[model samples]
Target: MISINNLTFEIGARALYDEANWHIKPGDKAGLIGANGAGKSTLLKLIVGDYAPTSGSISMAKDLKIGYLNQDLLSYHSDKSILHVAMEAFERQNQLHTEIEKLLLKLETDYSDDILNKLSDKQMEFEALDGYSIEFRAHEILAGLGFSEEEQKRPLATFSGGWRMRVMLARILLQTPDILLLDEPTNHLDLPSIKWLETYLQAFEGAIVIVSHDRYFLDRIINKTVESRKGKLTIYAGNYTFYLEEKSLREEIQSNQFKNQQAKIKQEERLIERFRSKASKAKMVQSRIKALDRMEKVDEVDDDNPEVNFSFKFSKPSGRHVVTMENISKSYPNLEILKNTDALIEKGDKIALIGANGKGKSTLLRIVADADNDYEGTSTKGHNVSQTFFAQHQLEALHLENSILQELVAFAPKHTETELRSILGCFLFTGDDVFKKIKVLSGGEKSRVALAKALTADANFLVLDEPTNHLDMASVNILIQALQQYEGTFIVVSHDRYFLENVANKIWYIEDKKIKEYPGTYQEYEAWSAKRVVKAEEPAVKKVKEEPKKVKAAPTEDNKRLLQKKNKELAALEEKIAQQEILVKDLEVELAKEEIYSDAVKLQDHTRRYNSEKASFDKLQADWENLAEEIMELEG
Candidate 1:
C-alpha cells in the first residue's frame, strides 16, 4: 500500500501533478490512464521511488515490498537462461537448496555431531520456506508470459528485445511483491498470453497498479481507473467502459456549471455597466464589482474533444482486388516463420490477422505489403492499389534527425505540405511541435508522426502492423472508428483485442502451420479458437457403453434381502435416470432459449445428451426386462 499527500511534480514549466492526494490500498487493482504526456508513468515512477516528487511526500507501509516493471529494462546480458533469470525471484530458496545439497555431501564425509546438527537445522529451515515448489511456480509464470518450454532452457542473450521484455515480465510476475506496478504490461503479449495474465492478476494476492493503452486489457483486468489529466487525478470506481460513461456524465455536469457561470458573469457585467453610468448608483456598482473580483470561477475540466476530430480523406477508391497473396512462406534460418500462407484483400474489406507472438502474423503482413521480398510468395497488387505499410519497427527505424514536419513531407505528396501540416495538427502536433526534430521525439510522438504519414499514403489498401503501439486509448478508438467508416481494404495485425473486435469484419488466424479465416468479429473468433484449443487438449477416446456392476443382497434378518437389494439398486438407477431426465428437460427448455442457441458448446452438449439419454433408456428397459425374467424363474 502507498499514499501520496499534496504531491506536485513539475517538468520544466508544465506541472504533471499538482496537489494530488491519492492512496492505493492493499489488493487494489487500479489502472493509470491519460494522454501521452499526462504523466501516468511518471506518477507510477514516483510511487516506486524512481523519481522523487518536486513537492510533498509519498508514504508506504513499513518494510513495504514493491516491484515495478517499466518499458525501459536495462539490458540483462549474462550466461543465465530465461528460466534461471525468472527463477531469481526465489534466489534465497535456490541458495538454500544449494546449501542443502552441500550438506548432503558433508554428511557422507563426516559423521561429527556438529555437522549433523547443522545439516538438520538447514533442512528444517528450507522445508519451512516450501523451497521445493519454487521451480514449478517460476515455470508457471514463465509459461503464462508466453515463454515456451524450450525457450526457457535457451540462453537469455538469444532472445529479441520483445522476448526480453517478456522475460522481465515473467520475473516480476513470479516475484509476487506486495505492490506491483506495471507500465503497458500487455503491449508485447499475444491474445493467449494476455488472457493468461488476466487470470494471473485476477487471482494475484497483491496490490496492482497498471498503465496500459489497451482498452480491452484494462477493462478485463482493472477494477478501478485512476485518470491523470492536467495536474490532477480523478478516480473512477469501475472498469474502463464504466469510467468512459461516468466521465462523460461528470463532464456534462461540469459543462452545465461552466455555462451557468458564464451566464452569471455576463449578468453581473451588464448590471455593473448599467449602474456605472449613474452617479447615484456608483457605490452599489463598486461594491458589486468588488464582489465579482473576489469571486473565483468554478473549475471546468479542459475538453480535448475538438483535438480528437481527425478526418482522413483518400484520393479515391482503387480497383476491385486491392492485394493478393499466394503460397507465401518465410523463413529465417532454422525458424520457419510462415509456411504456405495465402490471403486476399478485396476492395473495402476490413481484415484482422491475429496469432500468438512468434507465430509469423507480422511476417505474413509484411509479405502482403511487399516490405520483405526475400520470401517465397506471389503477392499481387491490383491496378491503382498503391499500397502503404506500417511496420512494428517503423518508429525506431525512422530518420531521427528529420523534424516531424519533415518526416510528413518526406512521405506525403510533393505539393501537399499545407494539407499535411493540418493533418499533423489533428493528431496533436502544431506550431513548434511540427518543427521539433524526430531525434528529440518520444516513443509516442514518433508513433503519432508515423500514423499521420500512413493516413496520407493516398492508397486504397492499408497493411498496418501494430499501428496502435504507443497510442493512447482515445487515439486508438478514433483510429478504429475511422477504419470502420473507411471505404478501402484494410489488413492489420494487432494484439489489442478491443480494436480488432470493433474494426475487423473478417479474421485470419495463423496457427499450427496453416492460415484459417473466421467470418465474424474478434469475439467470435476468440470463442471458436478457445473451443478448438479445448478440443485439442481433450482426451481422444471413444466412450463405449459401460456395463453396470452388480452388488449381492445383504443377508439380514431385520429386512427382506431380495426386496432390499432390488430396491437399493432401483433407487440408485432411478436417481441417475432422474438426473439425466433433468438434463434433457433443461436442454429442451434451452432449445427454446435464444441465448443458449448462440453458444456452440451448449448446443453440442444438448444434442449429445439427447442421443445419450435415448441409448440409456433402451439399456435400462432391457435391464428391467432381464431382471423380471430372473425373478419369475426364481419364483417358479
Candidate 2:
C-alpha cells in the first residue's frame, strides 16, 4: 500500500499538484486519467520516486515492491533473446534453479548431509516460487503480447520500437510486483493483445495504477478512477463510466453554485457603492463590505473540451462498390500471412478491420489501398474511387523540417493561406501553433496533423491503419465525430474499442488467413463471436458422447495400452481438479474479505474466476468418470 499526504509537486512556473492527498490500498485498481500534460504520468513518476514532491510526502511500506512501465521503450541487451529479457523478472527463481543444478552436480561427485540439506532448502524455495512453470508462463505471456515462438528466440535488437515496448510490458507483468504503475500500457497493443492484458490484470493479486487513453481497457480493468486537473486530484469510487456521470453532475452543481455566488457578490457591491455616500445605511454598507471581503471567490472552471470541426470533401462520388478483391493472397519470404482472402467494400461502408497482431489486417488494408500491389489478387477500385491511406507510421512520414502550416499547404497547395489557417484551427492548431515545426509536435499533435491532411485530400475512400494509436481521449473522440460525418467509404484498423464502437458500422474480422465480414458494430461482432464459440463447443460435446457408442469390438493389446494411458491421464486430471478446487476455495475466502468485497470490480473478477475454476474442475471430474467406465467395460 502507498499513501500520499498533502503532496505538492511543481515544475518551474507550473504546479501540477498542490497539497493533494491520495491513497492506494492493497488490491486497488485505479485508472489515472486526464488530458495530455495534465500530470497523469507525472503522478506515476512521483509514486516511483523518480520525481520528488516540492512539499509534503509520499509514504509506502518499506518492503513494498513497485514495477513501472514507462511510455518509452526500455533498452535491452542486443545479443539477448526477447524471452531472456522477459525471464529476468524471475531473477531470484532463476538463481535458485541454477543453485539446484550446481547441487545436483555436486551430489554426482561427493554428497554430504549438509549439502543435501542445502539442496532440499533450495528445491523447496524453487517450488514455492513456481519455478517449474516459469518458462511456460514466460512463453505464454510473450505469445499473448504478440511475440511468435521464433520471434521470442530472436535477439531483442531485431524487434521494432513498438515490439520492444511490448517486451518491457511483458517483463513488468511477469514481475508481479506489489504495485504496478503503467503509463500508456495499451499504446502499442492490438485489440487481441489488449484483451489478453485485461484478462491477466484481472487475475493479478496486487494493486494497479495505470494511465491509458484506452477507455474500454480502463472500464474493464480499473475499479477506481483518479483524475488530475487544475493542480488538484479528484477520486471517483467507480470505473470510467461512473466517473463521467458523476463528474457531469458535479460540474453542473459547481457551475450553478459559482453563478449564484457571483450574483450575490455583485448585488452586495452595488449596494455598497450606492450606500457608501449615504449616512442612512453606513452600518449595513460596512457589514455588506465585510461579508464581501470574507467571501471566498469561486475560481471559474476552465473548459478543457477539444473543439474539432472538419468535413471530408470529395471531387466525385464513387461507384456502389468502393473496392472489390478476389482471391487475394500475400506472402513474405518466410511466411504467408494471407491466403486467398476475398473482400468487398461498398460505398459509405465504415468498416473496422480487427485481429491479432501480425495477422495481415494491415497487409490486407495496404493491398486494398494499392499501397502494395505485389500481392497475388484481383484488386480493383470502383469508378471514381479516389482514396487516401493513413498508415500507422503516417505521422512519422511527415517532413520534420516543415512547419504545420507548410505541411498542410504541401497537401493542398491551391488553398489560400487564410483557408489553410482556418483548417488548421479546426483541428485545434491555431495561431502560433500553426507555425510550430512538425518535429516539435507531440505524438498526438503529429497524429492530428496527419489526419487533417488525410481528411482534406479530396478522396472519396480512406484506408486508415491504427489511426488512434497516439491520440488521447479527446482527440480520439474528435476523430470519431469527423469520420462519422464524412460521406465516404473507409476502412480502419484500430484497437480503440470506444472509437470503433462509435465510427464503425461494419466489422471485418481477420483470422486464419481469411477475412469474414460482419454487418454490425464492434459490440455486435463480439456477441456474434461469443455465440459461435458456444455453438462450436456444443458439437464437441456431442461428438464425445457419440464416439463411445460406436465402439463394438473386444479389447485388443493396443486397447490395453490405451486404457493404461487413459488411467494415468485420469489420475493426473483428478489431481489437477483437486488443486483447482482448493484454489477456488481460497478465492472464496478472499471474496469474504471486507476490502475485496467493497470494490465491485475486484469482487466481480474474483467471482468470475471462482466460477471458471469450478467449471474446469467439474469437466475434469466428468472426464475421470467417463474414463473409469470405459476401463471397466474393457476389463470385462
Error of 2 at 483 (Å): 1.0
lDDT of 1: 0.79
Candidate 1 lDDT for residue 605 = 64
lDDT of 2 by residue, 18-52 (tens): 89899999878899999887888888888888889
Q: Could you tell me the lDDT of residue 620 within candidate 2?
A: 77
502 in model 1: Cα distance from truth in Å?
A: 2.0
> Taking the tens digit of each residue's C-alpha lDDT, what string does model 1 give over 507-530?
987766667788889999888888
RMSD of 1: 9.5
lDDT of 2: 0.85
Compared with the true structure, model 2 gives a TM-score of: 0.87
